[model samples]
Target: MAPACEPLPVQLGAPSTADPHARYARLREAGPVHPARLPDGTVCWLVTRYEEARKALAHPCLSTDPAHASPKYEHPPWEHGPPQALLAEAAGRHVLHSDPPAHDRLRNLVNRAFGTPRSAFWRRDVERIVDGALARLAGRDEPELLSGFALPVALAVISEVLGVPHALRARLEESAEALVTVGGRPATPNAARAAAGEVIRLMTGLFREKRAAPADDLLSDLASAADEEGGPLDEGDLIATACLLLFTGYETVAYALCNSVINLLVRPDQLAAARASPALLASAIDELLRFEGPGDSAALRYTTASVRLGDVDIPRGECVLVSIQSANRDRCRFAEPERLDISREPGDHLAFGHGIHHCVGAPLARLEIEVALHRLLTRFPALRLAVDATELEWHHLMPLRSARSLPVRL
Candidate 1:
């Protein structure tokens, strides 16, 4: 480690706080990995800068499992419950928390169900979902979008994909909001646990229903994701994997929508550029992903051994938070890094991460963003923020960024 700097503290910000893009600019200016501390005072390292970050993300030395994380940190690996485990631990042994052959195993099983969204059937469903939301917004006066539009669209698409029954969706939403939150972190541990538990009960029963009357959908395939001997995954494994897929897409996609739409609204010029060329919407979504992504850091990855990134050597077992927000805005890779250019192709932003841990739902997420934004903008050409940009409340999620609500008047 070069070892000449003030420690960068990552977890101090309010869950609703916004990133000080400048702080990252300085980190990139100096070096990549820096000695840092978690909110719990566990000595760790923070990696910014593009090249070093890409290396760190895909590096063999980094372990995604919380068991491999620095042991000094306070709280149990799954303290905030399974949804949190979905983010941190390889708990229930799902992919986001896994590595290598195990990661490949879990991912392949889930992939059988999450087939291409680009197919005519799925695209029509997505379009219908998006257009319905847009249509509802059209007649309202200064419609509030967080719950009304963004959240529902995200949930509906995933529900359709998951084959969650309509009857359970209300409970699912209540429990889902309890288990995980958008533009924010999950609820308190006890609350999240209860919510997560309810979700488990609901999904487990849903899976059983599917078993008796097998449906041609993702949840059915997952409920039946076989073990080495070809029997269905046990109850706990089934629920964990089931919730993993739903929880993974639920809030992140919604918050991502909030981020991109708010970005366009606040910058009229960029908004105009996007509106002028429908062809550029896809590129704009990529830029939005790079600019204000769903996460600040990739899930905590523990170093397996001392590894040198640039001049800094991250020690064994210390959790390394790879700053995707910082890396995506890196001037070394992105020209005019701070500027929001809808046309610029921000290549391979770590928005969905990289390598073995790349988001399995990347295509679904892109489909959501592209369809939601395109339809929203096209349907309401005069759509603009109803409130001043400064009044917009950001979610206080450290590492994850999103707006609490977006108020717009057509």
Candidate 2:
């Protein structure tokens, strides 16, 4: 049990990009939870162990709302900007940032677009998008996979699915990058607001366009939603949902591909196994996600009431970050957790998170990875890392992890 008198707060910065799991392992052994201060200077409880983290993520008293943050915590610009800043607020208030009835309402409204049937419908489109990306990747020397292939595929898939205009796609990519930096980097508050504000503005315009001239896409479906399905989304709800979907779909899939690629390249046996067996490939992808999913932690959760987690009591209004990165690698929950074995049974991991707040886009993400990896490996069977594995750099962003670049020779 941790001492009742809390020790000095652990200053939490981004872990070493090269191998963060090592850091998380030490933190888990230290305690189930720690009083920590974020690089941005916000203080919170950091949950590290598997059972404690799972419970913390699912606990109803732990909220995703900024309103529950302690007074000592300085709110981000997106949370309390000017009234004309509704776009910023909306971006901050997306499905990931609400609780209870509001969370349920937003989730239900957004689910109509990402339901199982809709995801199934996306497979052929995803393969088309992947094929097009692969075509562009040919005839390049030492091509950087992150920019050359992975990101473009992810961006194209989301754009096609949402019917984003070609003209707005580049700007959408820029804004999404800024949002990721805002999520993990020590970005200035004003810069964060500007980035989020720009995304909201873009999404707002798209929502209106979809409403005026509906297309057979998710954005159109959301824009033209009627009260029968769920009340029509207001400007804020529409923009927020669009931004959330765009940013999430864009960020996670791109990194997961890069991470999976690097993971396989380092171990040829695993790569050969994945390429040879579709069944093994499916299992391997899940294992890769569990081993190195994009999310290091879920969005910061606020405690609505005092909650006890593994001998430590988190008081009301405090922030809690359940480290998905740590919990998935927990030895208690996984046998020989450090070893990456694609043949093992897929275990429930918090990569997409747990409980009501679990990621709704999980199916689409999986579909994209499966198609992209299959096509990529089959097309370029001789592909190998252009740079030494240790020389590779990772993006040390919180709530996400990915290589900065993956130079490959085809």
TM-scores of all candidate predictions against the true structure? 0.90, 0.90
lDDT of 1: 0.75
Q: Tell me the whole-model lDDT of each prediction, alpha carbons only.
A: 0.75, 0.78
**Can you write out model 2's per-residue Cα lDDT over 1-410, one digit (the tens) per residue?**
55422354766655465687887787778889988777677777889899999998899999877778778765641221122134436544666777878678778767877773666679898999899989888988779988788888898898888889889988987866655542234345576567777777787788888888888788887677633354554567556766777767886789899889999889999999988987778667789999888777777788889999998988998889888889999999999898888897888888988988898888889889988998999999998999999988776656667777789999
TM value for model 2: 0.90
Q: Enumerate residue pairs that collide in model 1.
A: 15-395, 15-396, 15-397, 16-395, 16-396, 17-396, 296-399
Candidate 1's displacement at residue 336, Å, is: 1.1
* Candidate 1 lDDT, 225-315, residue by residue in tens: 6533444444555567677778767777888998899999889898888888878887678889999987767877877888788887777
Error of 2 at 267 (Å): 0.9
Stretches of candidate 2 off by over 4 Å are: 2-8, 74-92, 177-195, 226-233
Instruction: At residue 290, give the lDDT of candidate 1.
Output: 91
